[model samples]
Target: MPAGPPGKHNAQAGGLGSVPALGRPERRAESLAVAGLQPFSSVDFPGRLAAVVFLQGCPWRCGYCHNPGLQSRGPGAGPRWPELRDWLARRVGRLDGVVFSGGEPSLDPALPDVLDELRAMGYALGLHTAGLAPRRLAVLLPRLDWVGLDIKAAPTDAALHDRITGRRGSVRAVRESLALLRSGSVDFECRSTVHPAWFTDADVLRLVSELSSVPRHVLQLARLPDASGTARAPIAWPSAALLAEARVIRPDLQLRAA
Candidate 1:
């Protein structure tokens, strides 16, 4: 499009200049600091060690959103990545890996630089995305070691799912991403959050059946929390009737109810 405030290259007149077209990197060997880092995590991705990165900003306004503070993109906060990079620089031998999570880390224009930096740091990479921008997955999937994709709902009807996400195009994006990643190189899993209002037994079965052929899909029964958002109350789990339906439908289904 126009220009990138003269960081490295100048866009040619009337050309798509310097944006690097989704997956390509125009420059590396320079600034590649990750925005945020959580020293260690147990629940981020199954068994591997990871650091939670809080990349700022997101496009959707799902009511079930847990990190509301990360929704808004604020003014420059003095490059958290540089310091993160320095921190990682010392832990090259100590930790397992890094996870680039966010308000939607993929949406951040600087993700490539940060990911580029992480790669240089010699740590394995993992990601958690809501599948907002499916096309970008083609680019980002190659960079990650594992992916935990939050699948909102069935692609058959957008309105039902959109009511929760508050975004019309999210279902389409999520579906497209699932289809595209069915045969990709990265190790990935698809999970749907089950809350009282958003899902019914039939709905869960439909969701699982639709994704029956996907390589590594997982169904995560999201534990609904109390008003404080910190303390969780143990409500009755998903119905055994629904569980039976899923078992009957997808023999290879991977489900965990919490």
Candidate 2:
């Protein structure tokens, strides 16, 4: 999508840039609130065996969020950062990288320092974020090896985008973040979680048309939550016609099943 000039929404209240950076004294490894950790994952970081650190807390509330438990900022019964780091330390040469997946990794103030520490230990770092923190992301970009940016909707569809995220003015922040990634040297991919319940065929086409210029844009089917709240494969898929049209708009568009 065309990267529009920043306007009032870009400066909206509660943007991550408003959060103060952690002072040196408070930049401890444990300062990162850990919701959970995946010891090893081949898929989390493309082309690498890596551990996924699931950080706690997120600003948005997407209905299709798989990590809903991570939405809260309050302390949970998850591993401590020091403990997780010690485990990663032992896998120094065994793993190719470390991925910071999260309710929103950029929301944590300690992230910049944490990235520095992991980078020094010789692990390429990756981040999974929804672009809720454009200013924070700008600071973290120089330290990242790869980033998976989650796009909820076309940048021009602010109402639809905010509705999906259950947050106001999210499109503005995501737009700025997308612009940052486009202008930077970092390798990144744009991904959107799609479900017929949430996105109609026209919605999918609009999103893909806007992302036509992105090097990699993935359309991942959104998993449904069973009665027990476990994520299961989607019962339905986007129409074949829609997928065909999407590819015509962005030939490089990738469709992934849940």
- The model with the greatest TM-score is 2
Clashing pairs in 1: none
Q: Which tens-of-lDDT digit does each residue in 112-145 have in candidate 1?
A: 6667677876878887888888877778877778
lDDT, candidates in the order shown: 0.63, 0.78
User: What TM-score, over all chains together, does every model reach?
Assistant: 0.78, 0.86
lDDT for 30 (candidate 2): 64
Q: Assess candidate 2 and give its TM-score to the true structure.
A: 0.86
Colliding residue pairs in candidate 2: none
